[model samples]
Target: MTELRGEALYWEAFERLKSGKAQIIDTNSPSFKFTKDNVAIEAGKKKGFVKQERYPDLCDSIENTENTRCSAASRDPENSDSIKLITSQKKKANARYSKLKAEHDLCLEKMMNLLRENFELRRELQELKKSSMQ
Candidate 1:
């Protein structure tokens, strides 16, 4: 006979219960109590509701802020659009930003190159003047 241990057995039992493959024998059975405790423990861990800090309340506040921002953005007349239009506009804005950044970098590179060339020409001119005077 195969023996399951720890979380493996708990998960197998949970899956069986969820799929109706197994039934609870008694309301107050040890297996039922174990499952209930396991569920509560897993839920608390997943939601970060441990006694260390009030992370769950902080998470709720963060979610509320996100919802508020989404609602405000949707309410804006100038920014309101269907999902497709909004996605397309976002892509266009990103493309424009990228293109501008590339152009700015290219301009900076060309300016640096020009300054280096100018400095080299000035040094050559000074050498020629000194040679001609001698």
Candidate 2:
């Protein structure tokens, strides 16, 4: 078959993955993270099988496909630590947001208090002028 390029190649890979024909995997991929596994897997140190297929066929479809639907990414028992890490990251982000929100509320309160004081001072000065005129 003639080689696919650009959009065609992207779709080819996408359709292969979407239809369960092939998949995207980091292992043996050209990306920095997977490049090393090419050797390790070949050396039989890692227990993985290689297949000649389109993109994204390596990991279980559940791990990759669950996000496209309503269900959570189904993880193997060993991947619970990854889920924990994601939860911890969410907590850290929430704490930062709460701190910033509290600081903003305090600043807003101080600004409103200053505006009220300025208005009262102006009113008092106007009354003093009227008394002096009388």
Assess every candidate by TM-score: 0.40, 0.45
Top candidate on TM-score is 2
Clashing pairs in 1: none
What Cα-based lDDT does every candidate model obtain? 0.53, 0.50
For model 1, residues 60-86, the per-residue Cα lDDT tens digits are: 433464466568757876555555586
lDDT of 2 by residue, 1-134 (tens): 44445324444443444454444433322221222233224333343332224323333332344354323334354346666876898899999999999999999999999999999999999999999999
Residue-pair clashes per candidate: 0, 5
Error (Å) of candidate 1 at residue 119 is 0.5
RMSD to true structure for each model, in Å: 17.4, 12.4
RMSD of candidate 1 to the true fold?
17.4
Quote model 1's TM-score.
Answer: 0.40
What lDDT would candidate 1 get against the real structure? 0.53
